[model samples]
Target: MVRKNIIISSLFLGLVSASPLHLKRQDLPIDSYDESVAAGADSTDTPPVGDAVPQNVETFDSNTVAAEVVATVVDTPPAVAQASNDTPPDVIAVNLLKRSDMNVARADGPATSCIVRTFNGPQVSDPDTPGAFTSYPAFSTAAIDSVKAANVPSGYAAVPNFVNLNAVAQDKSYITYTSSKLTSYDPKKCAAICDATAGCTSFNIYYERVPLEISKATQVPDAALGCPGNADAASATLIKCAFYGMPLVATSAKSVYQYQGKAFKVVYAGSTAFTKSSGPTVDGLQGPVTFGDAAINAPAPVIDHGYLRTQTFGTNVPFAPELCAASCKAQTEYNAKHGTNKGQACIFFNAFVIYKNGKDGVFTCNYYGTPYGVSYAKNRGQWDDSGNHWTISNSFGYYVPGNYVAK
Candidate 1:
C-alpha cells in the first residue's frame, strides 16, 4: 500500500508539471513576441501581475491575442501611448509646453505705445503795411556795384544784348519766382531752378523792400494820417529769383509805380539777370530764327517729301535746338539708305514749347523733309477730345541751307 501511494503522488506531480496553467509560448504569435521585444520589452519579460490593458488598445480576444499582449507588455504611459498614435510622445510634450509658456509671457508683458503729431500751416504776410525801420539796413551802393560787376553766375555767361538792362528796378515777364526768405540769396540756385523748369529761358535776381505788417487804417489820399500804402512802413528786404520764358529785354524792364504819394516808396535794387548760353551746335544747320508762337505748316516738296515724325522732351532736358537738328540729320541719313522714293529726306525741323492749360508742358520737335519759311508757321494749336487745351509758343525753325543733298 505504501508503494502504490508513493507511485500515485509521483504521477500527480508529473501531470501538474506537464500541463502549465499559464498560456503556452506557441499560443502567442512569434511576430507578436518580436514586436514586443522591439518596443523596449525583453522577450524574457512578462506583464506585471493584475495590470490592466491600456484603454486606447483594442480588447483582447483569440484573434487579436498577439496585439493585445504586445500593448500590455510594452512599458508605456496611457497618455503617452495615446499621443504616440499620431506623433512622438517627446515632441508632442515639448511643443505643448513651448506654446503655453509663450502665451503666458505675452499676457504678462507691457502694452505697445503709439504717438500722433500735428503741424500748423504757414502764415500769410501783407506787403503794403509799414513796419519799424525807415530804410533797408543791408543796402549799400558799393554792394550793388559789386553785384553788377559779377554779372553772371559760375556756370552762366552774360547776355551781351541785355547787359544794359542789368541793375534796373523793373519787373519782366516771369513764369515763377522764388523768395530768398525761403532760401539764401543764391543766383546759382536760381539758375539750377531755371534749368529744371520746362520753358524757362532766363532768370532775374533782385532785391525788393516789403512791409512787415498789414495796415488796419482807413484808405485816404492824404499820406500823413492813414495807411495809403506800405512805402513808409517798416520793411524787410527780400531777394527774388524770377524765371522767364524768354531772354531779358530792355522793353520789359520799364516797371514804374507809386502808391499813396512818394513817402512810402516801394523800391527795387541790386537787380541782375542771366541766361543759359551752353548748348549743342550742329554743323550745316541754318536759321534758329524765332517763330514767336507758331509751328511750320509747309507743303510737301514733291509727292514724297513731307512731315516725317514728332518727338517730345520732358522737363529734365532743356529746350535744345541742336537735338532736333541731330535727329533731322539722322532721319536724312536713314532715308538715304532705306527710302524707296527720291527726294525723301528730312531737311528741316521745328523746335517749340507746348503749354498745357497755360503752363509749360513739354519741349517738342517736329521733323519735315521739305523746308518752310517763318511766314508759313500757321499752326498755333487746337483742342483735343478730352477738352484739354494745348497751345504752342517759343517756336524756332532750323534747316539745312543751299541744296541739302542726302548722302
Candidate 2:
C-alpha cells in the first residue's frame, strides 16, 4: 500500500463525558538489553513536536487508511456523573520514539487462539426467595464442563490461540452486549462472535440478574403492565456476553455498580474474559512482542533519535501492527531516496490500542530509528481533564535486529 504524505499540524482534541477513574500503571521487571548506539554532534534526537510534518505511508495490507481525520465519540451512561478536577486539567500528552523498520505479513483470518478461566462469585436473587443468593461456584468451570458433557455445537469448536485474561467480565471498551436469549453462555460461541465482528478482540461472558419487565407502578399482575418499587419484582438471570475492541485486563474488571434501579438491582455472576493471543506478524520483525500494557519509552541513542512519524487508525480498521511495520519500512525508504538522514533508518516501531473514555477508539503506531526492549515500555496512559480517560492496551513493539550501522 502507498500513502500520501500526511501533514500533522496540531494534536486533535475532543470532549467526553465520564467520571474520572485513574488506573495505576503496572510495573514490569526489565531484562538487561542495551540499545545504545553511538551519537554524533549532528544527530537530531529531540522528539517531534506538534508542528512536525509526518509522511503518510502505506501498510502491507490492502486496507486503505481513512482519508479524513477521525474523532471518536464515547458513550456515557446516564447514571454516571461527569468528571471534575480540583486543579486545572492536565494537557493531553503521549511520549513518542523515533524511526524503525519491520516487514509485515497479511493476516489470513481472525485469530484462532483462545483461553478460558473460571471465577467464583455470588449470584443475584430476591431476598424473599426460597434460597439466599450465595457464592456461585466456579461459574466458568461449570459452564465449560457442562458443554463438554454434551454434544459440541457445530462451528463452536475451541479457538486454538484463545487465552484467559481475567476472572471477571471487563467493564471497559464494550461494543454492545446481548443475552443468552439471543445467543448462549458458551465462551467458544462468544469467541467466534468476536472473531467474526470487525474490531472485536476480546469478549466477556457472565450471568446477570435483571428485571423480568420494567414497570413504574407499585401493584400489577404482570411487570409488563405495572410493578411496584417494592424491590421484590420478579427477576431473571441472563447469560450475557459483551464484546470489546481491545484486550481485556483484570484491573479493569472492577466489580462495583452493575446498574441498579428502584425496583431492580442488576448484578453479575461467574464472569470470565478472553483475548487474542497474538497480533499480525511481519517476516523480518523481531516482534509483535507484548509490552504488557504500556507503550515504548526508549531513551534516545542520539539527539536525533525521536520518532519519524506517528499514525492513528480508528476502530473501523482493526488493530494491525503490520501497518506500523509498513510505515516504518516506508519511512526508511523515503529517507534513503531523499538523502535526508545522514545514514540512519527506521529500526524499530511500537503499536497499541488506545481507549478513550473507556472505549477502544484509536490504534496508534510510532516508528523509531533506534531499537529498544520491553524494559523501555513504561508509558501506560493518562487522564485528561477534558473528562476523557486515556488507557493503553495490548501494546507491542517490533524491531530490526543488529546494531545501528549507518550507511
Candidate 3:
C-alpha cells in the first residue's frame, strides 16, 4: 500500500511539471519506448519529445540605421541666420547735402542782394562779367544742352542777388524799368490781368539786371531758357515772363523725395501781396504783355526731381516713364533739328503726364525741359550700371525716380 501511494504522488508531481510543448510532444514525459514511439511517428505527422525544436533570431543591417538617423534629423529644428543692421537705431545724424542760397535783401537796393526766383523757360544764360565778383561766361546753345551745365551752384555769382526789383512795360509792349520805380510787379496780379485781357499772355516782372562787366567784352542780362547773354548795357531791364498751357502730371520719381514733386502755382516769387521792381532799362524783343489786373487763374508748375532711376529695360515706371528719363537721342536730336519749329528737343524731362482721359481715350506724355535731367541722362550710361545694357536710345530725355499711381 505504501508503494502504491509513492507512485500516485510521483504521477501528480510529473503532471504538474509537464509544459504544453511536453504534453504535445508525447503523452508521457519519459519515452519509456516500450509503447513503440517509432510506430507513432510513422503513423502521424506530429513531433515527439524534443525533436524538431524552434530556434532564436540574431542580427540586422546598415541602410535601416541610416534611414532612422535621417528621419530624426528632419524632425529637429534648424538654426536661424543673423539680421541686417542697415537701418539706424532710433535717433541718428544725417546730412542733407542741399543748401538754399536765398539772400533776401541787401543794401544794393534789393537789386544786388535778392536771389532770382521765378522765371520762364528752361534756357538760362549768364552775361559775361570781367572784373565782377562772379563771371558767367558767354553761354551758347551747347551750354543749354547739358543740364549739369545748367546746374550752376546755388547762389552762384551768375545766380547772384538782385535789388530794386522795379519793372515797367512801355509802349504797351516793351519791358523797361528805373530804380525803385514801379515799386511792384505782382505776379499773381499780373496773372489775373492776363486772364482778364485777351491779347495778354505774359508779364515782365522786374528785378535789377546786373551784367558781368566782362573785360574786353559787353555786359549782359542773365536769361533762363531761350535768352542767351549778349552785349547789353547796365541800363538793361530784366523781366521774368511766363506763359500758359500746362498743368501736366508726373509719371514717377526717384530717391529721398515724395512721389509728387513740390509745386507752387503763383509765378512770381515771395508772398501773394508784394511786388517790387528793381533795375535799369532797355528795349527790343517781344516786350511784356500789358494789363492792369493784379492776379489771374494760373495753374501751378510742378518742381521736378532731377535724378535718373532706370533699369536694364528702361525707366522703372511702366506708364509714361519714358518721358522723364535721359537718352542719347536727346543729344542727337538737339544737334540735328535745333533750328526747326520744335527748336531744341528737351534733353531731359523735368515733368510728364500719364493717364487716359474719358474725353480722349488716349495716354499723353510730355517732356518739359530740365536743366538737370538733360545733363544726367547724357552722363548716366557711364555711371548707372543698368543703363549700359539697353540699345542706344533714339529719343530725347531724363526722368524723376519715385513712381506715383492714382486710380
Name the candidate that leads on lDDT. 2
TM-score, predicted candidate 3 vs. hidden true structure: 0.16
**RMSD of model 3 against the true structure:** 45.3
Give the range where candidate 3 is weakest over 10 consecutive residues by summed lDDT: 3-12
lDDT, candidate 2, 278-380, per-residue tens: 6656777776677866887544332244434345543333465655665566556655554333334878877776665554335667666677677777777
Q: Rank the candidates by lDDT, best first.
A: 2, 1, 3
lDDT of each: 0.41, 0.44, 0.20
Candidate 1 global TM-score: 0.38
| Global Cα lDDT for candidate 2 | 0.44
Superposed Cα deviation of residue 292, candidate 1 (Å): 1.7
Considering TM-score, where higher is better, how would the candidates rank from best to worst?
2, 1, 3
Poorest 10 consecutive residues by lDDT, candidate 2: 30-39
Give the TM-score of each candidate.
0.38, 0.50, 0.16
- Which residue pairs of candidate 1 clash? 128-230, 130-233, 130-234, 131-233, 131-234, 132-234, 231-264, 232-264
